[model samples]
Target: MVLYKNEPLTGHPCSRPMARECVATLPASYFSDPKVFNLELQAIWSREWIYACHENRLRMTSPLEMTLATFPISLCLSESGSVAGSLNALTGKPDSRRIHTHVLNGFVFVNFSDAPPPFESTHVGLADEFKSVEHVFTEAEFDFWGHLSLPGAFNWKVFSDNYNECYHCPTSHPQFSKVYKIPSYVVDAREGYFVHSVEERQEGGKAAAASNASVTELLLTESNESFPMEAKRLYDESYSALNQKIKEYAKANPPRARAKAHEGGLFVHVFPNVGINVFGDFVTTLRWNPASHEKTLLQLEVFVRKGVSEAEMLRFSNFLKWVEIEDYVLCEATQKNLALGVYQVGVLHPFRENGLVHSQAQIRKRLVEYVSQERELKEKVGKQRDSSTTLSEESGTLLN
Candidate 1:
């Protein structure tokens, strides 16, 4: 489907088109229909290079067994310490076919197809962006903190739709709104991915200071009045112990600050299912694991500098989880509404939700192709059957 945007004619600033063009989202059936989900698995999931994990997770002693888009895969360390993956059958045994695996910037990607598209060419925009900020993701400079997997009762596309735009961020993510300048946030869609960039609110800015004060006040009240006497004592002692550990850890490992391109945040969303979030002191990988049409597992893996304190990391994790939960609620509600017969389609803001527009366009293109292929296959089979019937009739007539 071709979509057009309203634009001013060249050299005629006042000649703006009067017609308002709006991009419509995919039909609601795409979200909850099992048949559409199966088509996506065959066309999009199987052909795309799905992000698996960081190389650090792989060990020579034991292979990592996990499911990617419901396909079981086992990743192992090769003799040269590189990543290798194998597709497993229903019996939990490796099949003769080997899954195609590629490692880029220490992150592993797997494709279930026999002949997958060239990674760099297929993901030109993502590759270029990663190359530009290559210094920030050097494997040796960071440690894998851990991973968080949150299951949701929504389609993977719902999460992708939520991630593709920040229009709802201000109202949906209050804490996040204070930390980042929402007005300046931008999501630029490229060839095969989307880039999200935003500047942080100034450290001493009124908004930042107010947010910090509120958080401090909340923590103090919770620790002091909300807990029982014994619990309060335990909390106080734990806080002190954690502070000491932070100090000791900081002393042992001084901060190794790396130069960044700018004092802003950067995120890349590779089409189908991967996100790379880059921050000042840490990086995270986000994946949407689709189990069914209405189920998805959101996975987040954190990698931080060695000098980051345990307390700080914990706080960051908590904040991330909070934001994710807020999003989950919204997505789940949206999913439920979509499943209802009341709504079949919705309009998208051409500029604000352009990322979502791009994503849906990609999906629509793939499904269209799948439908075309199915039609051709049926036609071919029908022709062969007709030919076989004609030959049998001719043989029987000649014998009579």
Candidate 2:
């Protein structure tokens, strides 16, 4: 089932039970309409568990600050290490909005809704998957170096669609393609979020750890050796310095075998917003917030084990900046094209674009549920009004 350019997919965007083909590209209005955006803001953004920041920020500062659904919320870490999030106000009494907080694996998550699902239940088996990094996460030994915020002219979902899949890496990111086995990348759509993994495929169809090399190993091996001499020299210099740090880290804290065999590094997309990308040695977090129908504010932060060397930290920061810049360019261009009105929808690769597919499905599902609730409330209200009118008319007739 294919849809032509500018042709509408059958059924309303807010309709329940959308066919797979119709969901390939969301209606352009989903990205542009203010009303639809507000519906999503209330339905999905305000209710779901949003990935905010790491606990390290709380350690460095009393109240970790952030914005959610246009509200300026300040999160404070109590003496008990329990996080309390509150909305700020300038005058009058404090706002009465409830801010729910949940901390998992040293990562801070908050929900604007009064209640959200338990983190463990929502995430399914993610805790077991992170058992290998218990020392880094559970011990709170990771340091939050800094964050880079990139504002671009694209809907936040557009950037999400780009980040969730690696299908375009071969043509779009030559440097990334060199290190990552794009064909082997896959996303596991959990109940509330998606987990991505990359692994080399074996002859028997079983997944292996990139031929026994983890992400860090591949980074140290493939990237430095495959690039041109100029790039190679820079990498060699960087590695020569970073190798000392690695040796010290290993000597102090010997590497432990991962509890679970998830093959490559893990990248998690926690519905609607937070993106946590974990490499073996370091982790990069991405926060997506919508500024307008056509604009989004993205914050990218890199974190490493508490005592990582400055040289090694700089390498990860530089790599993130370069790759994210590439993504910004692509997303910005795509946003412009989307606004041109020449193309309203486009087909997605059935196998490769499943991440985008799952995300869109989640979005549509929430919208449908919201719409259904609204409809039911409206009908109930109408019935109450009619009953009240009938009672008034009968009283008047009896009085006459």
Candidate whose lDDT is highest: 1
lDDT of 1 by residue, 1-400 (tens): 5354466322322222211356888888788877678778877898888899888777423488888898888899877987889887757554546899988888898998889888887766465566667555567867766565667789999999999999999989887897888877767766667788777777523333222222321132244333334433433443444344444555667654434322233598878898888764578898999999999998877777676554455455445655665687788888899888689989888667777877888898877766666556657767654554432332222122
Task: Provide the overall lDDT of each model, using Cα atoms, as 2-decimal numbers.
Answer: 0.70, 0.64
| Per-model TM-score versus the true fold | 0.78, 0.73
- Candidate 1 TM-score over all chains jointly: 0.78
Looking at candidate 1, what is the lDDT of residue 357? Answer: 76
Model 2, span 344-391: residue lDDT tens = 777666457767776877787787776666556657767654554432
Model 2, residue 335: what's the lDDT? 85
In candidate 1, position 34 carries an lDDT of 70
Clashing pairs in 2: none
